[model samples]
Target: MGPVRAWRDEEEIELGPRQQRAVLAALLLNNGIRLSNDQLIGMVWDDPTPSAVMALRTYVYKIRKTLPELNLKSRDGGYTVRAEIVDDCRGEPLEGLRSAYFDAQRVRLGDSRLKAREDCLERELDVLELQKHVAAFPLRERPRALLMRALYLEGRQGEALDHFHQVRALLIEELGLEPGPELRKVHAQILNGDLTLPRRPEQLVPDLIDFTGRAEEIAQALRTLPGTVGITGMRGSGKTVLATRIGHLVKGRFPDGQIFVRGRDVANELLRAVGVENPVGDKAALWREKARGKRFLVVVDDVQDAATVRDLATPGSAMILTSVRRLHELPGVTWLKIAGLTEREAREFLRKAFGPVRADAEPEQAEVLLERLSRLPHPIRVIGGKLSSRPGWTIEMALLQMERESRLADVIPSDCAAMMAPLIAAEKQLSEPERRMLMCFARQDAEVIDSRKAAEMSGADAGEIELVLESLAGVHLIEPLVLGRYRLPRFVRFCFGLRTAELTS
Candidate 1:
C-alpha cells in the first residue's frame, strides 16, 4: 500500500483483513481478466487449505460489500474486477506485477495527449511537469523531445534549444554518447522554425546586461555599407560585445532572423541556425540556398582565419565577423579595429560594474583599479563579477591582489584563462621567426617597437620583421600605432614575457 491506497471519493475505504486485501489486490491486478477459483485459492493461501476456496469466496463477498463501485463479477467459475474500474484505480500494482508495463502505459498516455494541450497555457504547464518527470527516467528520449516540442509550441524557441543542449551536454559528458536520432530530429525541426509562431524580430545573442560603452563604434557598424564588416581586436577587447550590440540594433532590418555563430563549423552552424539538418555535399552552396532572399544578420564570432569568414559570408546578407586575427582583405569587407576603452569610458564601465556605492565612496580607488586593469573590458568584467559576488572585498583590495600576484591566473578569474587560450593557440600556429619577432617586444623596455627596431633585436630581416609585426597586429596581439609602429597591450606583454621566460629557462 505504499503508493497505492484505495479511495472512494473523499473517503478512504478500508480494504479489510490481510487475506481480504490480498484477494482484492489479486483481482485488481488481473482486472478485467477473470481469475479461476483455483488461481484465487493459490493466491490467497500459499499452502492450500481444505477451506481455501470458501475463504476466497468470503474475501470476495467482503470486498464487494466494502466497495460496491468495483463491479467485481464472478464469471466462468472465476472472479474479475471489471476493466473500466482499473482506470479509476490511482495506485500502482503489487510488486513484480507488470509495474514496468503499466508505467510505460501511463507515459504514453501523457505523451499522446501533450499536443492537444499545448495551446492552453494552464495545460502546457501540466505537460511540462509531466515531461520533466518522464525525462528523469533513464534512456527515455521521448519525454525530452516532447518537452522541446512543447516549449517551441509555447513560443520559447531559445529555451527549447537551450534545454536540448543541456541534455546533449549531460549525455556526452556522463555517458560518452550523443542524444538519439529522435531527439536530434526534434531539435532540427525547432531550428528550422517549423512551428507556427509569429515571427517577431529575435536577438539570439545573449543580452549584454552590463554593457557600458562603445556608442560610436556601435553606430558606425550599424551604418556601414551593405557588406561584411570585420571587427579585429586584442583578446577580450570587447569585439564580440560590440558586434552583438550592433546585431541587436540592426535586427529590425533583418526580419528573417539574426544568427550568431561561435563555432568553427560555419556551414553547419549557419545551416542549423536557419533550420537545416545533416546538410549533404556542397555545404557552402546549401548555406547560400537557405540564406537566399532572407535578409538576416550573421555575426561570426571568434573567427581564427579568413577562410571561415569567406565560407560563412553569404552575398546580400549583412555579416559581422569578430576575430583576434585580421582577416585577409575580402571584397566588400570593411575593417573595424577595436581599441581599449578611453579613460572616461573605462571609468564609467567600472562604475556600472562595481555599482554606485563603491564608485561613489572611493572615486580615487576606482580609478586606480581601472588603470591597473589596463582599461580592458574583459578583466574589468571578470574582476567586477568577482568583487560583486564578494561584498566584503573592496576595489582597493582587488587592486592590491592584482599587484601582488603577477601571474594571470592569480590576478584574474580562472575562466579568463579560456579567453587567452585562442591567442595562445594562434601563437602556436606561427613560424619560429614570426614568434621570435613578437617575443622581442616582451624583452624590450619601450612599449612601441618599429620594424627596424624589432629586426635589430631579433636579428631577422627588417622586411620579414615588418611582415611578422603586421601579422601580429592583424591578430590584435599587438596594436598598430601611427607611423608604422606596433605596441603590445600591457597584459599581452606580460603574458608574452611569461611564455618567453618559460622557453628560455
Candidate 2:
C-alpha cells in the first residue's frame, strides 16, 4: 500500500488532482471493498462541499477513463474498484498525501510493512527499527511482543523487562487494563525464559510517565505539523516532554524515522542518522537530498536559537522545536507557549504520585500546595515524588514547612537534585545584566513588574532595565504583558528565590 500507483504491464497510469488521487488511495487502501459515495467523500474531504457526491462520481469516471484496463463498477449505490494490490512499501504509503484518513491508512500500512520486514529477517533483528514500530503503535501487542523477542535474543533481558513495564503502565493508565494476553505471554516468556523480546522510542527518550496535561496544545501542535511547530516555555515547564510526546504520536506519519538532536554536533547527529556519514562540504545539501522524497521527523530539543536550525526545518519533513526562547523570527513556524500546569493538571500529578485517595483527602491543602509550587511540572513531580516516598509526611505537613520556609532550598527534597539542572543550564545562558535582573525579579513582590520597577530594584537606568527586560522576555524568563509590563513566570521566580535564599543564607 506504499506510493499508490496503477500500471498496465510496463506502462504506468496517470492520476488526477490531489483530491481525486486521494479517492484512489482510499479505494486502494481498502481494495475490492464496497465504498458508498459518502464513505469516499468522508475519507478524502474534511468538509465536503455540496457538490461532493458529484465530485466523487467524476473522480470515479476519470479513474475508469484513465486506466481502462481495470474494472471500476458502481452497483447498489456503492462503488468498488477491482485490481491486484501490489506492495513493496519502498517509501511512505501514498507519499505527499495529507488527510486524516490517509494518515490512519499510512500508519496501518507502515505497521504491516514493519511486520513483513521483520518476518523476512533471517537471523538478526534491528532493535531500533522495532522500537520505532512500538513507538508508533504503542498499544499494539504485536510490536511489543516482537520487541521482547528481539531484546531477549540480544541478551538484553533487563531492557526487555523494562519495556514490558513501560507498556503495562501505559496500558493500565491509558486503557484501564493490563497488557493484552499476547503481550503478557511475551513478557512471561522473557522472564521465565520461555520466549523472545521490545515508545517515545528510537533516538528519543521515553515520554514522561505522568505526562499530565496540555491537551489543546498537543492537538494544535500535531495539527500544525507537516510544517514546523515551536514550543516555547519557561525552564523546567516540560517543553521537551511535550515535544517528545508529539514525536511519538507522529512517528507513523513519517515513514523514514525520527531523529532527535539535543546538543551541539547537531549537523553530525542529523547527517549520520540518514547515512550521510562524515559529510564534508554542504552538509545541508546532503541533508536536503536525503530529506527529499521521504517522510521523517526532526525534534530539536531546547534549541538556543531559531536561526541555528532554520534551514533544517525545510519542506521535506516536519520539525518540532522546543526552546525557552520565543523563536519569533523563524519562518513558517507556529509557536505554542507552556507557562505551567493548570490547577487541575497539578492536582492530577499529585494524585498520580500519592495515589488518588491520599491526594483527594486534602483537596484544600493540595490547592494551597499547588499555588506555592506555582503548578510547574518538574517541581511538582519532584516534590510530589518526594512527599510520596516519605509516608510519614502529609500534604499538610509539607505545607507547614513551606509556610515558614525562609530558604526555599531547605524545603526541596534532597533527592531532587536533577530538578535544578535545567534552571542551572538556563542560568549559564543568560547575560550578566539579564541574570541580575532575574534575581531582582525574585526579590520583587509585584505580580507584573515594569521596567521602572526593575530599575528601582536594580538601581539601574530605566532605559537599560527595559533592554534587560526585553532580553529576559525574549528567552521567556519573564512573560511580556500589555503596556510594557512583564511577569517573571511563577516557576522561574520560585527558582530565583531559591538561588537568592541560598546565597544570603
Candidate 3:
C-alpha cells in the first residue's frame, strides 16, 4: 500500500513493515484468487528466501488479527481475500497504493457492472473519478474512449464531443499523434448527430518492425506536455525512432496534424502541414500565425542548429526534437539522453529481430553477438535483419565474422558508415587542439577522462581542455560524467582511435 495502513470501521489498523504492505497489496489485487505461498514470497521479496513463506504466513496472521472483518482464508495451498470483503470496503479500494496499474484496476472494477446496473448517475461519477486518475497518463487512449462512451450514453453529446476534442488536442500537443479509429468514429458520430457511426478507416504509418525497448523514455517524453522535449543520443542510438514512436503514440492528441521534418526543412514542413503553398511572407512568421490556434505535434528531427529548434517551436504547439547533439541553447526543453540497451533489452531485441527459434536456440551465441554489437539497437537490428534474411547464416557465424573484422564499419551494416560520416565531419570541424584532445581520449584505456588528465595527455592547459570537453559534450560526441569527468562510448572511442592511427600511419 502507498502509506501502508488498513482500516476497520473508523479505526486504523497498522500493517507492519514494507513487506507486509506488499503482502496486503498482492492479496488485495488478487482478492478472489488464491495466491500460492511461492507467489506471495516472490511478490514480497525480489529474491525470495527459504524463510519467506514463514514470513508471509506471519504477515497474514498479523493482517487477519488487525482486520478480522476481511475474511482472509487459507485454501487450496494458498491464501485469498474474498471479493465480498472488497465490496464492503468503505474507503477507496487500495487507497494508499497510488500505482497507476492499481488505479486502472479500480476503475475497471468500478465500471464492470455498469452495463448491468441501472445507476447511470453512479456510472457517470465513476467515469469522472477514473478520468482524474487517467489524466496523469496522457499517452493512454482507452480511458478517454470510455469517458466519451459514458458521456454519449448519458445523452450529453456536446460534452462527449468536447471531451474528444480536449483529449485529441492533448494527444497532439503532448505526443504528436492522432486519435485512433475508435475515437475518430465517436467524433464522427457526434458531428453527424447520430448515435452510431461506422468505424472510420484507420490512417496510420506502418510501425517499425524492429522497434524494441525505450518504453519508459517514450512515456517520459509523452508526459512533457505543452513544452519541447529533446531526445539526444549518439548517432544510431535510436533517438529518431524514439521521437517518431512518441509522435505516433500521441498523434491522436494532435487532431490538427503532426509535422515531422529534418532540421534543414522545418520551415518547409511546417508550411506544408499547415497547407501553405508557396508563401510570399516570412515563412517563420506565417508558420507561427497559422499554428497559433491549431493543435499540432511538431517533430524536428536531426536538428543541426539552435535556429531550427527556435523557428519550429511555436507558442501553441508541442514539439519533439531529436538530434545527435544536445540543444543546450534552447530553454524550457526537457532533454532525455538515450544510451545503449541493457543486456536483457538487447537479448529481447535480438529475439524479436531474428526469429525467437534461432535466437533462443543458441543463447550463448546470441550473447556473444550482442556484445559484438555493443547492445546498440540500430546495429543489433541491422545484424538481425541480415541474419534473418539469410536462413543459412547462424549466430555463431555472424559472431565469428564480427570478431575477425578489424573495423566496426566492416562488422556493422554498410549504412552505418553514412551515419558515422556526419559525426566524423563534425569532429573534423573542431579546432586542432580540440581534435587532439579527443584523439587523446581515444588513446586512453580508461572509461572516463578528466580535464586535468586530458590536458596532460594532449599537452594543452587544463582550462583549454575543459572548454573543449564542454563543446564536445554539447555536440554529444562525449558524455559528461560526475565531477566534471567525461566518458566516450566504446564505439566512438574505437572509431576515433582508428582514424588517429590512420592519420599517423
Candidate 4:
C-alpha cells in the first residue's frame, strides 16, 4: 500500500502519469468503493486546477487503455477500482508526491509498515538485526522508540539514552516539531529505568528535494567516507542543505544511528547522546569512550571552532560539519569549499526549478537576473518558487520587475522568500569594525572592491583596511581575490546595499 502502482500476476503493469496513478490508488486503497469526480479531484490536487474533471477523465481513459485486464468501472457518477492493493518499500509512502490526501495516507500507511516491522522484529529478538532494520526507516519514531527500549533492556542503557537524544535532535532537525507523546513516553520510561524490551532505524530527512549540482563535491566527500567532513561556504551558498542531503544518502554505512547536532552546545549534546550524563570528570575521555567503536554519523551544523567537534569523531564513524566560514582542521577531516553554482549549473537549476526560464533567454538577460540573485540556491529557490508558480512570468519580465523594485526583497513575495537566516546570523556576529568595513564594501555599486579604493572610501589607513578586510573575509562576508582586491557576492550586495544606502543617505 506504498505509492500508487498496479501489478497483475506478479508482473508490474505500467501506471500512467502520477495524477492518473493517484486516481487509481484512491479507488484501490478504498477498493470496492466508488469516489465521485470531486472527491478524486480533492485527493489528487493540493490546489485543484479549473479543468480537473476533464483531466481526470483523460487519465482514467489512459489507465483503461493501458490496463484492459482490470475490472475498473465507472458508475454512480464516479469510478471504482476492484483490485487489492499490494506493495512494499522502505520509503515514505507516495514519497515524492505532495498533497493533503497523500499526507494523510502517508501517516496511515507508515503506521501499518511500522506495525509489520515491529511484529517481525519482536519474533526474532535480535538487537543487531533490529539495528540494521532501523537503518532503513530512520524517520519512523515508533520503531526508534522500540529500538531504544530494546537497547536499554539489553544492558546498553547508555547507548539507549544516547539514541533518545539523537531521536530528539533528528525530530527537531527534520520536522521542526518536538517528539510526540508516544516517543516522549518511551524516553521517560528509559530514563526511569522502567523500559521493557522491543525493537528497530534510516534516511536523513532532507530539506532539499531533487537537489541539483554539487556532484563533484558529493562524490569527493563520499569517496572519503567514515571521516570528518567540513563543508564550508558563504552564508547563502547552501552549506547545511548540501550536508544534510549527502548525509541522508550515505546513512546505511552507520547502523548505530546518525546524529545531527546544531548550535553552540555541540560538545554537550554529543556528550549526552553518547550516554555520559554528567561526564564532569574527563568529559573528552568519557565522550571518546562512549563514541568509540560505534559506526555512526554526526552532522554538526553552523559550527564555529574545529576543536569543539574534533574529538567527537571517534574511530569507526563519520562526521559532517557545515559552517559559513572555513574551519580549522581535525585529523583526517576532508574539507569541501562550496561556492556558488557555476553559470551552467545555475541555468540548469533555474530551468529545472522554474519552467518559464526553460524558454530561450535573450543573451545575458537571464544572467542579469542571476547576477541579482548571485546564483545562490537560497535566492534561486526564493525567486524561482515564485516564478515556477506563475508560468506567465518570463525571465525578461522578471528582470524588468526586479529592476522596478527598490530592493530584491521588495520584488520577492514575502511568503515565498528565503529565510536568509544564515545571512542574519552572520551579520549579528560581526564585530564593529567588521560591520563598518562590510558596510563600506557593500556601499559601492561595483562588483569588486580594490583595497586601496576601499581604504580611501572608509578613510582608513592601509593597515587598518587590510585588517578589516581580513576580518570580513574570515566571517565570509567578502571573498578575497588576486591583486589585493575583494569580490562582494551579488545577493549580499542586494541585501546589505540597501541597508548601506539607508545608513549613509
Which candidate ranks first by lDDT, i.e. highest?
2
Error of model 3, residue 70, in angstroms = 27
After superposing candidate 1, which stretches have Cα over 4 Å from the reference?
A: 1-203, 311-316, 407-440, 443-445, 482-484, 498-505
What does the lDDT come to for candidate 2? 0.77
Determine the C-alpha RMSD for candidate 1 after optimal superposition of all C-alphas: 26.6
Residue 230 C-alpha lDDT in model 2:
90
Clash count for candidate 2 is 9
lDDT of each: 0.71, 0.77, 0.72, 0.74
* Model 3 spans > 4 angstroms off: 1-206, 389-392, 407-435, 443-446, 501-505
Summarize candidate 3's per-residue lDDT along 439-495 as a digit string, tens digits. Answer: 777766356878787777768777877888888887667778875698876656655
**Where does candidate 2 stray beyond 4 Å?**
1-201, 314-316, 403-405, 408-418
| 1 against 4, candidate with superior lDDT | 4
For 151-226, candidate 1 gives per-residue lDDT tens digits of 8887888988998898898788888999999789889999998754323235467868878778877777776834
In candidate 1, where is summed lDDT lowest over 10 consecutive residues?
115-124
> CA lDDT of 136 in candidate 4?
84
Candidate 4 similarity to native, TM-score: 0.58
- Lowest-scoring 10 consecutive residues by lDDT in candidate 2? 194-203
**Candidate 4 lDDT, tens digit per residue, 348-413?**
777667764353454377788777777888777767777777877777877776554434433343
For residue 324, model 1's alpha carbon misses the true position, in angstroms, by 1.7
On lDDT, the stronger of 1 and 3 is 3
